[model samples]
Target: MSQNLLIVGAGEFADIAYEYFTVDSPYTVVGFAVEKDYLTEDEKFGLPVVALEDSVTRFDPAKTEAHVAITSTQLNRVRERLIKKTQDCGYTLANFISPRAMVWRTAKLGVNVFIFENNVVQHGVQIGDGCVLWSGNHVGHQSVIGDYCFLSSHVVISGYCKIGARCFLGVNSTLADSVTIGADIFVGMAAVINKSFEDAGLILNGHPAEASRVSAYRYFKLKAPT
Candidate 1:
């Protein structure tokens, strides 16, 4: 059963999401929806581009599904905001779990999730809404990834770990068992986390992954998540 789907952007990530939904999932991509300000083109990949606010009118929300096709810009706040926007606009959100990825039947995932190839989401994992698990990542058992988090390729999240909202785990980063990360934190590339970080907005980097002097919001030049 291929459901009609509307990807919520027309950028690079949107193109990737469209291809994945069209080829792998049971989704027939019907169109794209983005803000009018960023809607540069009238069409993308041969689909019509509608304003995000107007998507529900163009495509009946009950009949169509939407997935936010945004990346880790502004520490994933962009994706986070867009997900909320779509939900508020009365559209049913969609999830794209790759056929190639081995997602455990017991693992629970939220709406608009994009799980790429070669990822292992182990038993009892709870991945929140709008998260992106990029290719080749390993999520160990009972881990909790919060809403709008982005885990880059090959990152390793060990057993029983908890990650907070709008966080970005860089490529090849490693988290030890039972570790907890707070909201809006950025784990730099290849960093290793062995302990829990309770504080929010920290920029973590290095082998043992110490927090840098600069705040994550400041480093990203973002005011904060509104």
Candidate 2:
């Protein structure tokens, strides 16, 4: 028998998770779960959009399982809120790791995680529950990613970094070794974090990027040493 699945958050991630469950997962996605305030649509991907609190009693978590599809683009507030709310309603969160993803045997993952295609999770990396690692992220060894975090595409997390809960690392962002990212922090796209962060708010791309002179020499076909 196929397990009945309900995806949380009916935005873009809901659509993506819907396709993955239908085509990739063995579970049968029957519905979606969202907060009553966020429930503007009646249905998503031809499935009912039930409120998070109503899901356990209505759909029955004893029979059906659920996953959260919230991205970490906006300070991880939505993802963290949904995770706490869902679990409080007496439902066990589900985890979705893509078959195409490369996770090391020693990696530990928490509940309600959605690891997408081509994600390379190295050895001894501890990923907390309700986390979403989007496509093409490279999680380095001995990294501890906290709960309800969202990592976007092509993110490079260097070794031994401690990422706090509900953090959002934007696309193509690179973190240096042993950096401690605080909870509810937002790293902007392609930003390089060479030091630890303790603030719990937005980190925008502050300065203009300097052009690489070596790369410029190579681009102009000059004699740039290898």
* lDDT for predicted candidate 1 compared with the true structure: 0.90
Whole-model Cα lDDT per candidate?
0.90, 0.80
Where model 1 places Cα greater than 4 Å from the true spot, the runs are 201-204
Give the TM-score of each candidate: 0.96, 0.84
Q: Please provide, for model 2 over 41-85, each residue's C-alpha lDDT reduced to its tens digit, 9 standing for 90 to 100.
A: 778767788778677767887888888888764456567777788
**Where does candidate 2 stray beyond 4 Å?**
206-226
lDDT tens string, model 1, 28-81?
999999997887788887789998877778988889988999999988988988
Listed per model in order, the count of residue pairs whose N, CA or C atoms clash below 3 Å is 0, 0
For candidate 2, list the clashing residue pairs, or say none: none
